[model samples]
Target: MAYKFALCLTLPHNTTKMKKKTIILLILAAIVGLAQFIRPDNIKKYENGVKTEDLAGVPKEVNEILRNSCFNCHSSSSELAWYDKITPVSFLVASHIQEGTEVLNFKDWMSMSIAKQKAVLYYSINKIRSGEMPLSSYILAHPAAKINKNQMQVLEAYLLSISARGKTDSVKLKALERDHKWVKPALNGIAYMPDYRNWKAISTTDRFDNGTMRIIFANEVAVAAIKAKNINPWPDGSVLAKAAWTQEIALDGSVSTGQFVQVEYMIKDSKKYAKTEGWGWARWKGDDLRPYGKTINFTTECISCHRPVRENDNVFTIPLNLK
Candidate 1:
């Protein structure tokens, strides 16, 4: 009788435990079923139908590597894998795709502006060189996507070639801008950039304490006038380009001037700039290449700096030949 009573007690406990597990399983089933209904597959964004063929003449080798490794997330040609069809998996895949394309989408390559395209290409090359791309997470499941040494070399060479082409195109664009008088939106400044590289070098200044280096170039007419020291009232169109750079300790332990810092252009415009002085000032910083300061304040700092030398046409550099 006691044994029977013990069995009766144990039976209810076991039954209760079983019932609890069943309830938990039912709740999990309901949660999973509900989650499936909230699928993100249909929600489309930035679905520009840009295609691989759009990059028409891209080399087969580079195209192969890009399609196999990059297209999964970085292109519109994303062919979702089996797991990518699932709820959260789909969400993650979509998010990665969105992010990858924003950075460098091969499909949209041709449509991007030349500058933007070159920037993306350079960025991509740097990332590849650093071995930061073909993310480990991606390569884990897709061994074929891993880039080999030879493949990297091929990509680097191809990208450099493309970058060289971009440089040529940029020069042509600048020439067009110079001749056609391109008027950029005023950032309190003017955008009258000339081919200052072709101008004659007048002088160079280096200040090591401040890590600053400057090169002054002058137009042909200005140089000739300075040689004769007859440039008292400087004629119009006599522009001076001062390119600045930053001094840095290079990898070889040598101190050298690094990337461009700024370019200050002093353009002689007697009638246009007679208000403050006889010079129209404009500046471009770093890789921006856009002129800065369109207002009179541009002259406030400039004029004040040149005030002490007002006796010399309100200019600073008298040139060696002028002496």
Candidate 2:
């Protein structure tokens, strides 16, 4: 009986230790819960910066380099990876993206003044050349974002080439901006005319890292063709608009889009647009509805991009998952 009583006395010491462990566990659980509740409100302010696939005027070879190394924070196409979903990590990502866009968002290339664009390009070249970009911390997490020597050369060359062209024709490009063709009212034509947001979302795509997200919306006629699975020549009168946004990151580690970036329209007219392969191409940029292809040279430039898909009715909406 005495020995049993002695053993019972030791039980209190174990219970005390158990109580401490339980308290520590409860504190940890509480801390985690509190962390979750204190998350950011995460308002989706506007279309994201601009997506990789949406970068206009960037050549394919250099585009690949940009997509591979610079797109994440620099472009609106930043989609966080699996590791970025953690709470504090996601917070850091969101903060970097917000700051990155403010510094210089490549997605705003077409929207910014040509002079400003040239200046930004030079700044970017300096940063990349000095190993200052793709942030060291960012590179630690995403080694792929590390710009290589060859890619650096290609990017700098492309930027210099564009800068030279801009310097030579800065006046012309600016003047052309006022002379938009396929004339519309002095209002935001493509954005407001039909209100693309109300249209059916035909498909969305990843642009690697040129820094944009592209979501295609189909007008009623085009939606019908998509639903019927009858987009052979994509009957005349069908309209499809692709909206580009700067891809941002939310506190939840999901893609949070920012303000309006760009939108492109493809109107089917087998007869009228036959020369361009049966599609009328037009692009409206920023909130002002700045026309992209203001001149014949620019208009034909659109053809080269779509020329590859000529067999697909001069449309890039083929692989889109329609709903």
Q: Mind giving the per-residue lDDT tens digits that candidate 2 earns over 1-323?
A: 99999889989999999999999999987886577655433312212333456455558887676667666777766766766645566678777777887887777666655555557767887888888887999999998888888888888788766656555566655554443332342222332243667888877876648667888888888888877787987989898889998877688967756766888888788898777667777787774566775454565777888888878877877635465
Per-prediction TM-score, please? 0.47, 0.43
Instruction: Compare the candidates by TM-score and give the number of the best one.
Output: 1
lDDT of 2: 0.70
Candidate 1 lDDT, 219-252, residue by residue in tens: 8778877887667877787888888888877789
Each candidate's lDDT (Cα)?
0.71, 0.70
Clash count (model 2, backbone only): 21
Give stretches of model 1 more than 4 Å off: 1-45, 49-60, 71-91, 101-194, 203-215, 224-233, 244-262, 270-278, 284-300, 310-313, 320-323
Q: For candidate 2, which ten residues in a row score worst on lDDT?
A: 41-50
**Model 1, position 95: C-alpha lDDT score:** 79
